[model samples]
Target: MKWIRKIAGMQSSILGINERNLGFIYPNNARKNYKYADDKYLTKNILHSHQIACPLTYAMIDAIGKIEQAWQATCEWNELVIKPSKGAGGKGIMILKKKNDQWFSQSKPVSEQDIFTHIANIIFGIYSFGDSDVALIEEYIRPHDIFYQIFPEGVPDIRVILLKGVPLMGMLRMPTSRSDGKANLHQGGLGIGIDMKTGRLKEAYDGEKHITCHPDTKHPITGLTLPHWDEIIRMSLKAAMKFPLHYLGVDLVIDQRKGPMVMELNVRPGLGIQLANREGLKDAIYRAKQENLLN
Candidate 1:
Protein backbone atom coordinates (compact mmCIF):
# COMPACT_ATOMS: atom_id res chain seq x y z
CA MET A 1 0.00 0.00 0.00
CA LYS A 2 2.81 2.42 0.85
CA TRP A 3 4.51 1.66 -2.44
CA ILE A 4 1.28 2.27 -4.32
CA ARG A 5 0.78 5.58 -2.53
CA LYS A 6 4.36 6.59 -3.19
CA ILE A 7 4.05 5.75 -6.88
CA ALA A 8 0.82 7.77 -7.16
CA GLY A 9 2.39 10.78 -5.48
CA MET A 10 5.39 10.56 -7.79
CA GLN A 11 3.13 10.40 -10.81
CA SER A 12 1.21 13.46 -9.64
CA SER A 13 4.48 15.31 -9.18
CA ILE A 14 5.48 14.41 -12.72
CA LEU A 15 2.15 15.71 -14.03
CA GLY A 16 2.55 18.88 -12.02
CA ILE A 17 6.00 19.40 -13.52
CA ASN A 18 4.64 18.93 -17.01
CA GLU A 19 1.74 21.28 -16.28
CA ARG A 20 4.12 23.99 -15.01
CA ASN A 21 6.26 23.88 -18.15
CA LEU A 22 3.09 24.15 -20.20
CA GLY A 23 2.01 27.17 -18.18
CA PHE A 24 4.18 29.44 -20.32
CA ILE A 25 1.68 29.08 -23.16
CA TYR A 26 -1.37 28.04 -21.12
CA PRO A 27 -1.94 30.14 -18.01
CA ASN A 28 -3.19 28.65 -14.72
CA ASN A 29 -3.56 29.90 -11.17
CA ALA A 30 -4.39 27.41 -8.44
CA ARG A 31 -4.50 29.83 -5.51
CA LYS A 32 -6.92 32.54 -6.55
CA ASN A 33 -10.74 32.55 -6.57
CA TYR A 34 -12.16 32.87 -10.04
CA LYS A 35 -15.62 33.02 -11.58
CA TYR A 36 -17.36 31.25 -8.71
CA ALA A 37 -16.33 34.09 -6.43
CA ASP A 38 -16.89 37.04 -8.74
CA ASP A 39 -18.96 35.79 -11.66
CA LYS A 40 -22.34 35.39 -9.94
CA TYR A 41 -22.47 39.00 -8.79
CA LEU A 42 -20.92 40.26 -11.99
CA THR A 43 -23.28 38.12 -14.08
CA LYS A 44 -26.32 39.24 -12.12
CA ASN A 45 -25.42 42.84 -12.63
CA ILE A 46 -24.22 42.60 -16.24
CA LEU A 47 -26.90 40.31 -17.64
CA HIS A 48 -29.57 42.21 -15.78
CA SER A 49 -28.33 45.43 -17.33
CA HIS A 50 -28.12 44.16 -20.91
CA GLN A 51 -31.20 41.92 -20.68
CA ILE A 52 -29.14 39.06 -22.12
CA ALA A 53 -31.66 36.58 -20.64
CA CYS A 54 -31.00 35.17 -17.18
CA PRO A 55 -32.86 33.85 -14.19
CA LEU A 56 -35.00 36.71 -12.93
CA THR A 57 -33.67 38.14 -9.68
CA TYR A 58 -36.78 38.56 -7.59
CA ALA A 59 -35.05 39.77 -4.44
CA MET A 60 -31.70 40.03 -2.63
CA ILE A 61 -32.17 39.95 1.13
CA ASP A 62 -29.28 40.67 3.44
CA ALA A 63 -28.86 38.84 6.72
CA ILE A 64 -30.41 41.72 8.63
CA GLY A 65 -33.64 42.56 6.86
CA LYS A 66 -37.37 41.99 7.12
CA ILE A 67 -37.26 38.31 6.25
CA GLU A 68 -41.01 37.77 6.31
CA GLN A 69 -41.70 40.66 3.99
CA ALA A 70 -39.13 39.45 1.51
CA TRP A 71 -40.65 35.99 1.67
CA GLN A 72 -44.12 37.35 0.95
CA ALA A 73 -42.87 39.41 -1.95
CA THR A 74 -41.23 36.35 -3.50
CA CYS A 75 -44.17 33.98 -3.02
CA GLU A 76 -45.61 34.62 -6.47
CA TRP A 77 -42.57 33.50 -8.47
CA ASN A 78 -44.03 29.92 -8.06
CA GLU A 79 -40.68 28.22 -8.52
CA LEU A 80 -37.44 29.76 -7.29
CA VAL A 81 -33.92 29.08 -6.00
CA ILE A 82 -32.77 30.60 -2.76
CA LYS A 83 -29.01 30.80 -2.88
CA PRO A 84 -26.40 32.49 -0.76
CA SER A 85 -24.79 35.16 -2.88
CA LYS A 86 -21.29 33.96 -1.99
CA GLY A 87 -21.86 30.26 -1.51
CA ALA A 88 -19.95 27.67 -3.53
CA GLY A 89 -20.18 23.91 -4.21
CA GLY A 90 -24.01 24.10 -3.94
CA LYS A 91 -23.91 24.66 -0.19
CA GLY A 92 -26.40 26.85 1.67
CA ILE A 93 -28.81 26.77 -1.20
CA MET A 94 -32.50 25.86 -1.28
CA ILE A 95 -34.93 25.22 -4.11
CA LEU A 96 -38.56 26.17 -3.64
CA LYS A 97 -41.17 24.69 -5.95
CA LYS A 98 -44.81 25.67 -5.83
CA LYS A 99 -47.34 22.85 -5.67
CA ASN A 100 -51.05 23.50 -5.24
CA ASP A 101 -50.59 27.04 -3.90
CA GLN A 102 -47.83 26.04 -1.45
CA TRP A 103 -44.09 26.15 -1.85
CA PHE A 104 -41.78 23.35 -0.84
CA SER A 105 -38.05 23.43 -0.21
CA GLN A 106 -36.31 20.85 -2.36
CA SER A 107 -39.71 19.08 -2.59
CA LYS A 108 -40.44 19.16 1.11
CA PRO A 109 -43.60 20.99 2.12
CA VAL A 110 -43.03 24.35 3.75
CA SER A 111 -44.87 27.58 4.65
CA GLU A 112 -44.14 31.28 4.23
CA GLN A 113 -42.65 31.28 7.72
CA ASP A 114 -40.60 28.27 6.82
CA ILE A 115 -39.13 30.15 3.88
CA PHE A 116 -38.39 33.15 6.07
CA THR A 117 -36.50 30.93 8.45
CA HIS A 118 -34.68 29.27 5.62
CA ILE A 119 -33.64 32.55 4.06
CA ALA A 120 -32.63 33.79 7.47
CA ASN A 121 -30.43 30.76 7.79
CA ILE A 122 -28.93 31.59 4.44
CA ILE A 123 -28.17 35.06 5.78
CA PHE A 124 -26.40 33.40 8.68
CA GLY A 125 -24.26 31.61 6.07
CA ILE A 126 -25.43 28.19 7.15
CA TYR A 127 -23.85 26.71 4.05
CA SER A 128 -21.66 29.57 2.89
CA PHE A 129 -17.99 30.50 3.32
CA GLY A 130 -18.93 32.77 6.18
CA ASP A 131 -22.19 33.98 7.68
CA SER A 132 -24.90 34.12 5.06
CA ASP A 133 -24.47 37.81 4.30
CA VAL A 134 -27.02 38.01 1.50
CA ALA A 135 -29.27 35.72 -0.49
CA LEU A 136 -30.72 35.95 -3.99
CA ILE A 137 -34.21 34.84 -4.92
CA GLU A 138 -34.28 33.98 -8.58
CA GLU A 139 -36.57 32.18 -10.99
CA TYR A 140 -36.16 28.41 -10.67
CA ILE A 141 -35.97 27.22 -14.21
CA ARG A 142 -37.09 23.73 -15.09
CA PRO A 143 -34.18 22.21 -16.96
CA HIS A 144 -34.86 20.40 -20.20
CA ASP A 145 -36.85 17.25 -19.46
CA ILE A 146 -34.48 14.88 -21.22
CA PHE A 147 -31.55 15.96 -19.07
CA TYR A 148 -33.77 15.85 -16.01
CA GLN A 149 -34.45 12.19 -16.70
CA ILE A 150 -30.71 11.63 -16.38
CA PHE A 151 -30.26 13.63 -13.16
CA PRO A 152 -33.68 12.93 -11.66
CA GLU A 153 -34.57 15.05 -8.52
CA GLY A 154 -31.72 17.49 -9.17
CA VAL A 155 -30.36 19.92 -11.73
CA PRO A 156 -27.64 18.53 -13.99
CA ASP A 157 -25.59 21.35 -15.49
CA ILE A 158 -22.67 21.71 -17.91
CA ARG A 159 -19.15 22.97 -17.22
CA VAL A 160 -17.08 24.26 -20.13
CA ILE A 161 -13.36 24.80 -19.64
CA LEU A 162 -11.93 27.76 -21.51
CA LEU A 163 -8.46 29.13 -22.08
CA LYS A 164 -7.67 32.60 -23.36
CA GLY A 165 -11.37 33.28 -23.98
CA VAL A 166 -11.89 30.19 -26.15
CA PRO A 167 -13.86 27.10 -25.26
CA LEU A 168 -11.56 24.10 -25.22
CA MET A 169 -13.48 21.39 -23.31
CA GLY A 170 -16.86 20.70 -21.76
CA MET A 171 -18.60 18.20 -19.44
CA LEU A 172 -22.09 17.27 -18.32
CA ARG A 173 -22.28 16.88 -14.54
CA MET A 174 -24.92 14.51 -13.21
CA PRO A 175 -26.22 14.42 -9.67
CA THR A 176 -25.11 11.36 -7.68
CA SER A 177 -25.13 10.13 -4.11
CA ARG A 178 -21.69 11.67 -3.60
CA SER A 179 -22.85 15.12 -4.68
CA ASP A 180 -26.03 14.97 -2.60
CA GLY A 181 -28.23 15.86 -5.57
CA LYS A 182 -25.90 18.61 -6.81
CA ALA A 183 -24.10 18.41 -10.14
CA ASN A 184 -20.70 19.59 -8.89
CA LEU A 185 -18.15 16.90 -9.75
CA HIS A 186 -15.79 17.62 -6.88
CA GLN A 187 -18.62 17.08 -4.41
CA GLY A 188 -18.77 13.43 -5.51
CA GLY A 189 -21.03 13.83 -8.56
CA LEU A 190 -20.25 12.12 -11.86
CA GLY A 191 -18.34 13.98 -14.60
CA ILE A 192 -18.87 12.73 -18.13
CA GLY A 193 -16.40 14.08 -20.65
CA ILE A 194 -17.77 16.25 -23.46
CA ASP A 195 -16.37 16.56 -26.93
CA MET A 196 -14.80 19.99 -27.41
CA LYS A 197 -16.65 20.76 -30.61
CA THR A 198 -19.63 18.40 -30.42
CA GLY A 199 -20.63 18.54 -26.73
CA ARG A 200 -21.31 14.81 -26.74
CA LEU A 201 -20.49 12.59 -23.80
CA LYS A 202 -17.43 10.54 -24.72
CA GLU A 203 -16.38 9.07 -21.37
CA ALA A 204 -17.39 9.24 -17.73
CA TYR A 205 -15.26 9.19 -14.58
CA ASP A 206 -15.91 9.49 -10.91
CA GLY A 207 -13.33 11.15 -8.64
CA GLU A 208 -10.88 8.29 -9.09
CA LYS A 209 -11.13 6.26 -12.31
CA HIS A 210 -13.18 5.69 -15.45
CA ILE A 211 -16.78 4.67 -14.86
CA THR A 212 -19.57 3.43 -17.12
CA CYS A 213 -22.45 3.20 -14.63
CA HIS A 214 -23.34 5.78 -12.05
CA PRO A 215 -22.30 4.81 -8.54
CA ASP A 216 -25.87 5.25 -7.35
CA THR A 217 -28.14 4.81 -10.39
CA LYS A 218 -26.40 1.83 -11.97
CA HIS A 219 -27.04 3.62 -15.29
CA PRO A 220 -24.36 4.47 -17.82
CA ILE A 221 -23.31 8.13 -17.87
CA THR A 222 -22.09 8.18 -21.42
CA GLY A 223 -23.78 8.62 -24.85
CA LEU A 224 -25.93 11.60 -23.87
CA THR A 225 -25.23 14.45 -26.31
CA LEU A 226 -25.86 17.79 -24.66
CA PRO A 227 -28.42 20.12 -26.22
CA HIS A 228 -27.27 23.44 -27.68
CA TRP A 229 -23.59 22.52 -27.60
CA ASP A 230 -22.54 25.26 -29.96
CA GLU A 231 -24.45 27.96 -28.17
CA ILE A 232 -23.15 26.80 -24.80
CA ILE A 233 -19.56 27.01 -26.01
CA ARG A 234 -20.13 30.45 -27.49
CA MET A 235 -21.68 31.69 -24.28
CA SER A 236 -18.73 30.37 -22.31
CA LEU A 237 -16.24 32.15 -24.56
CA LYS A 238 -18.18 35.40 -24.44
CA ALA A 239 -18.30 35.30 -20.67
CA ALA A 240 -14.63 34.43 -20.27
CA MET A 241 -13.59 37.08 -22.77
CA LYS A 242 -15.08 39.71 -20.50
CA PHE A 243 -12.66 38.89 -17.70
CA PRO A 244 -8.99 39.76 -17.41
CA LEU A 245 -7.99 36.25 -16.42
CA HIS A 246 -6.88 34.01 -19.26
CA TYR A 247 -8.05 30.64 -17.92
CA LEU A 248 -11.45 29.86 -16.46
CA GLY A 249 -14.44 27.52 -16.39
CA VAL A 250 -18.01 28.52 -17.09
CA ASP A 251 -21.02 26.76 -15.54
CA LEU A 252 -24.10 26.87 -17.75
CA VAL A 253 -27.59 25.45 -17.48
CA ILE A 254 -30.12 25.11 -20.30
CA ASP A 255 -33.72 25.94 -19.50
CA GLN A 256 -36.74 24.33 -21.08
CA ARG A 257 -37.81 27.51 -22.87
CA LYS A 258 -35.18 30.17 -22.20
CA GLY A 259 -32.26 28.30 -23.76
CA PRO A 260 -28.81 28.38 -22.06
CA MET A 261 -28.24 30.55 -19.01
CA VAL A 262 -24.89 31.32 -17.40
CA MET A 263 -25.10 29.81 -13.92
CA GLU A 264 -21.71 31.05 -12.64
CA LEU A 265 -18.03 31.27 -13.51
CA ASN A 266 -15.00 29.68 -11.85
CA VAL A 267 -11.51 31.08 -12.19
CA ARG A 268 -9.63 28.17 -10.68
CA PRO A 269 -11.64 25.29 -12.10
CA GLY A 270 -10.93 21.75 -10.97
CA LEU A 271 -8.51 19.74 -13.15
CA GLY A 272 -10.52 16.51 -12.91
CA ILE A 273 -11.91 17.60 -16.26
CA GLN A 274 -8.83 15.92 -17.75
CA LEU A 275 -9.71 12.53 -16.29
CA ALA A 276 -13.32 12.89 -17.38
CA ASN A 277 -12.25 13.75 -20.93
CA ARG A 278 -9.74 10.91 -21.08
CA GLU A 279 -6.98 13.35 -22.03
CA GLY A 280 -4.55 15.78 -20.50
CA LEU A 281 -5.85 19.36 -20.31
CA LYS A 282 -2.34 20.61 -21.02
CA ASP A 283 -2.53 18.94 -24.44
CA ALA A 284 -5.98 20.33 -25.25
CA ILE A 285 -4.95 23.92 -24.55
CA TYR A 286 -1.85 23.44 -26.64
CA ARG A 287 -4.01 22.34 -29.55
CA ALA A 288 -6.23 25.36 -29.07
CA LYS A 289 -3.15 27.60 -29.46
CA GLN A 290 -1.80 25.74 -32.47
CA GLU A 291 -5.16 26.41 -34.14
CA ASN A 292 -4.77 30.12 -33.20
CA LEU A 293 -8.08 30.27 -31.32
CA LEU A 294 -6.62 32.15 -28.34
CA ASN A 295 -5.77 35.34 -30.19
Candidate 2:
Protein backbone atom coordinates (compact mmCIF):
# COMPACT_ATOMS: atom_id res chain seq x y z
CA MET A 1 0.00 0.00 0.00
CA LYS A 2 3.09 2.24 0.04
CA TRP A 3 2.51 3.07 -3.62
CA ILE A 4 -1.02 4.07 -2.65
CA ARG A 5 0.31 6.62 -0.19
CA LYS A 6 2.90 7.82 -2.64
CA ILE A 7 0.22 8.45 -5.20
CA ALA A 8 -2.40 9.88 -2.89
CA GLY A 9 0.07 11.89 -0.72
CA MET A 10 -2.61 12.40 1.94
CA GLN A 11 -4.81 9.85 3.70
CA SER A 12 -7.95 11.82 2.92
CA SER A 13 -7.40 11.63 -0.81
CA ILE A 14 -7.03 7.85 -0.90
CA LEU A 15 -10.07 6.14 -2.47
CA GLY A 16 -10.80 2.45 -2.29
CA ILE A 17 -12.95 0.46 -4.72
CA ASN A 18 -15.93 0.41 -2.38
CA GLU A 19 -15.67 4.14 -1.78
CA ARG A 20 -15.30 4.83 -5.48
CA ASN A 21 -18.35 2.78 -6.40
CA LEU A 22 -20.60 4.24 -3.73
CA GLY A 23 -19.40 7.81 -4.06
CA PHE A 24 -18.85 8.20 -7.78
CA ILE A 25 -20.20 5.54 -10.09
CA TYR A 26 -23.34 4.71 -8.15
CA PRO A 27 -24.32 8.33 -7.78
CA ASN A 28 -23.23 9.69 -11.14
CA ASN A 29 -24.10 6.87 -13.54
CA ALA A 30 -27.75 6.14 -14.26
CA ARG A 31 -29.19 2.67 -14.83
CA LYS A 32 -30.16 3.49 -18.42
CA ASN A 33 -26.59 4.48 -19.22
CA TYR A 34 -25.40 1.10 -17.98
CA LYS A 35 -27.10 -0.67 -20.89
CA TYR A 36 -25.41 1.62 -23.41
CA ALA A 37 -22.00 0.92 -21.90
CA ASP A 38 -22.63 -2.73 -21.09
CA ASP A 39 -24.05 -4.00 -24.35
CA LYS A 40 -21.72 -3.72 -27.33
CA TYR A 41 -24.60 -3.63 -29.80
CA LEU A 42 -26.33 -0.84 -27.91
CA THR A 43 -23.04 1.00 -27.55
CA LYS A 44 -22.46 0.89 -31.29
CA ASN A 45 -25.95 2.21 -31.96
CA ILE A 46 -25.46 5.10 -29.53
CA LEU A 47 -22.09 6.00 -30.99
CA HIS A 48 -23.56 5.83 -34.44
CA SER A 49 -26.39 8.19 -33.53
CA HIS A 50 -23.91 10.66 -32.07
CA GLN A 51 -21.79 10.46 -35.24
CA ILE A 52 -18.79 9.24 -33.25
CA ALA A 53 -16.36 7.08 -35.17
CA CYS A 54 -16.00 3.49 -33.98
CA PRO A 55 -15.26 0.04 -35.34
CA LEU A 56 -17.90 -0.81 -37.91
CA THR A 57 -20.22 -3.63 -36.97
CA TYR A 58 -20.23 -6.30 -39.61
CA ALA A 59 -22.82 -8.58 -38.04
CA MET A 60 -24.57 -9.51 -34.82
CA ILE A 61 -25.88 -12.94 -33.75
CA ASP A 62 -28.26 -13.18 -30.85
CA ALA A 63 -29.27 -16.82 -31.23
CA ILE A 64 -27.25 -19.99 -31.67
CA GLY A 65 -29.09 -20.90 -34.85
CA LYS A 66 -27.80 -17.82 -36.66
CA ILE A 67 -24.15 -18.67 -36.03
CA GLU A 68 -23.74 -20.39 -39.38
CA GLN A 69 -25.36 -17.60 -41.37
CA ALA A 70 -23.38 -14.97 -39.44
CA TRP A 71 -20.11 -16.78 -40.12
CA GLN A 72 -21.01 -17.12 -43.77
CA ALA A 73 -21.83 -13.43 -44.04
CA THR A 74 -18.37 -12.58 -42.70
CA CYS A 75 -16.52 -14.84 -45.13
CA GLU A 76 -15.42 -11.89 -47.26
CA TRP A 77 -13.74 -10.25 -44.29
CA ASN A 78 -10.22 -11.60 -44.00
CA GLU A 79 -9.87 -10.22 -40.49
CA LEU A 80 -12.63 -9.94 -37.92
CA VAL A 81 -13.22 -9.68 -34.17
CA ILE A 82 -15.93 -11.73 -32.41
CA LYS A 83 -16.94 -10.71 -28.92
CA PRO A 84 -19.81 -11.05 -26.52
CA SER A 85 -21.98 -7.97 -26.70
CA LYS A 86 -22.07 -7.67 -22.89
CA GLY A 87 -18.68 -9.12 -22.08
CA ALA A 88 -16.50 -7.93 -19.27
CA GLY A 89 -12.77 -7.90 -18.56
CA GLY A 90 -11.98 -8.65 -22.21
CA LYS A 91 -13.43 -12.11 -21.88
CA GLY A 92 -15.05 -14.02 -24.76
CA ILE A 93 -13.19 -12.04 -27.41
CA MET A 94 -11.93 -13.96 -30.45
CA ILE A 95 -9.75 -12.44 -33.12
CA LEU A 96 -9.86 -14.27 -36.44
CA LYS A 97 -7.45 -13.76 -39.29
CA LYS A 98 -8.00 -15.50 -42.59
CA LYS A 99 -5.23 -17.14 -44.60
CA ASN A 100 -5.91 -18.90 -47.88
CA ASP A 101 -9.42 -20.01 -46.82
CA GLN A 102 -8.20 -21.11 -43.40
CA TRP A 103 -9.13 -19.17 -40.26
CA PHE A 104 -6.75 -18.71 -37.37
CA SER A 105 -7.16 -17.55 -33.81
CA GLN A 106 -4.00 -16.05 -32.45
CA SER A 107 -1.84 -18.01 -34.92
CA LYS A 108 -3.58 -21.31 -34.18
CA PRO A 109 -5.79 -22.55 -36.98
CA VAL A 110 -9.39 -22.89 -35.83
CA SER A 111 -12.00 -24.92 -37.64
CA GLU A 112 -15.41 -23.52 -38.62
CA GLN A 113 -16.93 -25.71 -35.92
CA ASP A 114 -14.64 -24.15 -33.37
CA ILE A 115 -15.93 -20.71 -34.25
CA PHE A 116 -19.51 -21.95 -34.15
CA THR A 117 -19.24 -23.41 -30.66
CA HIS A 118 -17.57 -20.28 -29.34
CA ILE A 119 -20.42 -18.11 -30.60
CA ALA A 120 -22.95 -20.54 -29.20
CA ASN A 121 -21.37 -20.29 -25.78
CA ILE A 122 -21.42 -16.51 -26.05
CA ILE A 123 -25.17 -16.46 -26.83
CA PHE A 124 -25.80 -18.73 -23.86
CA GLY A 125 -24.24 -16.07 -21.63
CA ILE A 126 -21.04 -17.87 -20.67
CA TYR A 127 -19.23 -14.54 -20.95
CA SER A 128 -22.09 -12.09 -20.65
CA PHE A 129 -22.21 -11.90 -16.86
CA GLY A 130 -24.49 -14.95 -16.71
CA ASP A 131 -27.21 -13.35 -18.85
CA SER A 132 -28.21 -14.11 -22.43
CA ASP A 133 -25.92 -12.13 -24.71
CA VAL A 134 -25.44 -11.32 -28.35
CA ALA A 135 -22.30 -11.88 -30.39
CA LEU A 136 -20.81 -8.92 -32.25
CA ILE A 137 -18.53 -9.35 -35.25
CA GLU A 138 -16.74 -6.19 -36.21
CA GLU A 139 -13.90 -5.00 -38.39
CA TYR A 140 -10.52 -5.84 -36.95
CA ILE A 141 -8.37 -2.85 -36.20
CA ARG A 142 -4.84 -2.77 -37.57
CA PRO A 143 -2.92 -0.77 -35.03
CA HIS A 144 -0.89 2.24 -36.10
CA ASP A 145 2.73 1.71 -37.11
CA ILE A 146 3.95 3.58 -34.06
CA PHE A 147 2.31 0.93 -31.84
CA TYR A 148 3.22 -1.91 -34.18
CA GLN A 149 6.88 -1.03 -33.74
CA ILE A 150 6.42 -1.59 -30.02
CA PHE A 151 4.38 -4.81 -30.02
CA PRO A 152 3.22 -5.85 -33.46
CA GLU A 153 1.03 -8.81 -32.56
CA GLY A 154 -2.00 -7.32 -30.77
CA VAL A 155 -4.12 -4.20 -30.81
CA PRO A 156 -3.11 -1.57 -28.25
CA ASP A 157 -5.68 0.90 -26.88
CA ILE A 158 -5.71 4.04 -24.78
CA ARG A 159 -8.04 4.37 -21.75
CA VAL A 160 -9.03 7.90 -20.84
CA ILE A 161 -10.92 8.76 -17.66
CA LEU A 162 -13.36 11.58 -18.17
CA LEU A 163 -15.36 13.41 -15.52
CA LYS A 164 -18.34 15.53 -16.52
CA GLY A 165 -17.19 15.51 -20.15
CA VAL A 166 -13.73 16.69 -19.17
CA PRO A 167 -10.60 14.62 -19.72
CA LEU A 168 -8.86 13.80 -16.48
CA MET A 169 -6.13 11.14 -16.88
CA GLY A 170 -5.07 8.56 -19.42
CA MET A 171 -3.01 5.38 -19.83
CA LEU A 172 -1.79 3.42 -22.81
CA ARG A 173 -2.35 -0.31 -22.40
CA MET A 174 -0.03 -2.41 -24.54
CA PRO A 175 -0.37 -6.08 -25.22
CA THR A 176 2.49 -8.48 -24.60
CA SER A 177 3.04 -12.15 -25.32
CA ARG A 178 1.88 -12.73 -21.76
CA SER A 179 -1.48 -10.97 -22.21
CA ASP A 180 -2.21 -13.21 -25.19
CA GLY A 181 -2.54 -10.23 -27.55
CA LYS A 182 -5.05 -8.40 -25.38
CA ALA A 183 -4.44 -4.97 -23.85
CA ASN A 184 -5.85 -6.00 -20.48
CA LEU A 185 -3.75 -5.38 -17.39
CA HIS A 186 -5.01 -8.40 -15.43
CA GLN A 187 -4.14 -10.50 -18.44
CA GLY A 188 -0.45 -9.55 -18.08
CA GLY A 189 -0.36 -6.45 -20.29
CA LEU A 190 1.67 -3.34 -19.60
CA GLY A 191 0.12 -0.13 -18.22
CA ILE A 192 1.93 2.99 -19.32
CA GLY A 193 0.97 6.31 -17.77
CA ILE A 194 0.40 9.20 -20.16
CA ASP A 195 0.66 12.94 -19.66
CA MET A 196 -2.91 14.23 -19.71
CA LYS A 197 -1.96 17.47 -21.43
CA THR A 198 0.38 15.99 -24.02
CA GLY A 199 -0.72 12.34 -24.51
CA ARG A 200 2.98 11.38 -24.26
CA LEU A 201 4.10 8.34 -22.37
CA LYS A 202 5.55 9.33 -19.02
CA GLU A 203 5.86 6.24 -16.82
CA ALA A 204 5.17 2.56 -17.35
CA TYR A 205 4.56 -0.46 -15.15
CA ASP A 206 4.35 -4.11 -16.13
CA GLY A 207 1.96 -5.05 -13.28
CA GLU A 208 4.84 -5.59 -10.80
CA LYS A 209 7.88 -3.58 -11.84
CA HIS A 210 8.51 -0.02 -13.01
CA ILE A 211 9.62 -0.11 -16.60
CA THR A 212 10.98 2.31 -19.20
CA CYS A 213 10.93 -0.23 -22.03
CA HIS A 214 8.54 -2.98 -23.00
CA PRO A 215 9.45 -6.28 -21.38
CA ASP A 216 9.14 -8.33 -24.54
CA THR A 217 9.84 -5.82 -27.32
CA LYS A 218 12.58 -4.15 -25.21
CA HIS A 219 11.57 -0.91 -26.95
CA PRO A 220 11.67 2.30 -24.94
CA ILE A 221 8.05 3.11 -24.04
CA THR A 222 8.34 6.60 -22.62
CA GLY A 223 8.79 10.02 -24.26
CA LEU A 224 6.98 8.89 -27.39
CA THR A 225 4.07 11.17 -28.36
CA LEU A 226 0.89 9.56 -29.60
CA PRO A 227 -0.45 10.71 -32.96
CA HIS A 228 -3.89 12.44 -33.04
CA TRP A 229 -3.40 13.35 -29.39
CA ASP A 230 -5.79 16.30 -29.40
CA GLU A 231 -8.45 14.40 -31.31
CA ILE A 232 -8.30 11.55 -28.84
CA ILE A 233 -9.02 13.92 -25.97
CA ARG A 234 -11.85 15.61 -27.83
CA MET A 235 -13.33 12.29 -28.92
CA SER A 236 -13.35 11.02 -25.35
CA LEU A 237 -15.11 14.13 -24.08
CA LYS A 238 -17.66 13.94 -26.86
CA ALA A 239 -18.38 10.30 -26.15
CA ALA A 240 -18.89 11.08 -22.47
CA MET A 241 -21.36 13.83 -23.29
CA LYS A 242 -23.37 11.45 -25.44
CA PHE A 243 -23.95 9.21 -22.46
CA PRO A 244 -25.92 10.17 -19.35
CA LEU A 245 -23.12 9.13 -17.03
CA HIS A 246 -20.92 11.93 -15.85
CA TYR A 247 -18.14 9.56 -14.85
CA LEU A 248 -16.81 7.44 -17.67
CA GLY A 249 -13.87 5.43 -18.89
CA VAL A 250 -13.64 5.67 -22.67
CA ASP A 251 -11.42 3.31 -24.63
CA LEU A 252 -9.92 4.49 -27.92
CA VAL A 253 -7.91 2.65 -30.54
CA ILE A 254 -5.72 4.24 -33.20
CA ASP A 255 -6.18 2.29 -36.40
CA GLN A 256 -3.55 2.47 -39.11
CA ARG A 257 -6.07 3.97 -41.53
CA LYS A 258 -9.21 4.84 -39.59
CA GLY A 259 -7.39 7.01 -37.05
CA PRO A 260 -8.91 7.17 -33.53
CA MET A 261 -12.11 5.15 -32.96
CA VAL A 262 -14.13 4.59 -29.82
CA MET A 263 -13.67 0.99 -28.75
CA GLU A 264 -15.89 0.87 -25.65
CA LEU A 265 -17.35 2.79 -22.77
CA ASN A 266 -17.33 1.80 -19.11
CA VAL A 267 -19.61 3.25 -16.47
CA ARG A 268 -17.87 1.43 -13.65
CA PRO A 269 -14.36 1.57 -14.99
CA GLY A 270 -11.66 -0.46 -13.28
CA LEU A 271 -9.42 1.02 -10.66
CA GLY A 272 -6.27 -0.35 -12.35
CA ILE A 273 -6.29 2.89 -14.38
CA GLN A 274 -5.20 4.70 -11.24
CA LEU A 275 -2.21 2.39 -10.91
CA ALA A 276 -1.47 2.75 -14.59
CA ASN A 277 -1.28 6.52 -14.26
CA ARG A 278 0.68 6.23 -10.99
CA GLU A 279 -1.71 8.67 -9.35
CA GLY A 280 -4.84 8.74 -7.23
CA LEU A 281 -8.26 9.69 -8.61
CA LYS A 282 -9.09 11.67 -5.48
CA ASP A 283 -7.39 14.86 -6.65
CA ALA A 284 -9.27 14.88 -9.95
CA ILE A 285 -12.47 13.79 -8.30
CA TYR A 286 -12.31 16.55 -5.71
CA ARG A 287 -11.30 19.12 -8.29
CA ALA A 288 -14.32 18.30 -10.42
CA LYS A 289 -16.58 18.47 -7.41
CA GLN A 290 -15.20 21.85 -6.35
CA GLU A 291 -15.63 23.26 -9.81
CA ASN A 292 -19.27 22.04 -9.88
CA LEU A 293 -18.44 19.95 -12.89
CA LEU A 294 -19.95 16.84 -11.31
CA ASN A 295 -23.35 18.51 -11.30
Model 1 over residues 15-84: C-alpha lDDT tens digits? 2433533563245543443533353665577655654556778888884567767777888777889887
Q: What C-alpha lDDT values do all the predictions have? A: 0.71, 0.87
TM-score of every candidate relative to the true structure? 0.84, 0.94
lDDT per residue (tens digit) for residues 1-295 in model 2: 4333343553455567688788878888887668889887988899999999999999999998899998899879999999999998899999999999999999999999999999999999999778999999999999999999999888999999887787777899999999999998878888888988888897677766678888888988889999999999999998998888888899999999989999999888766667677667887677767878765
How many backbone clashes does every candidate have? 7, 0
| Best-matching candidate per lDDT | 2
Measured by TM-score, the strongest candidate is: 2
RMSD of each: 4.1, 2.5
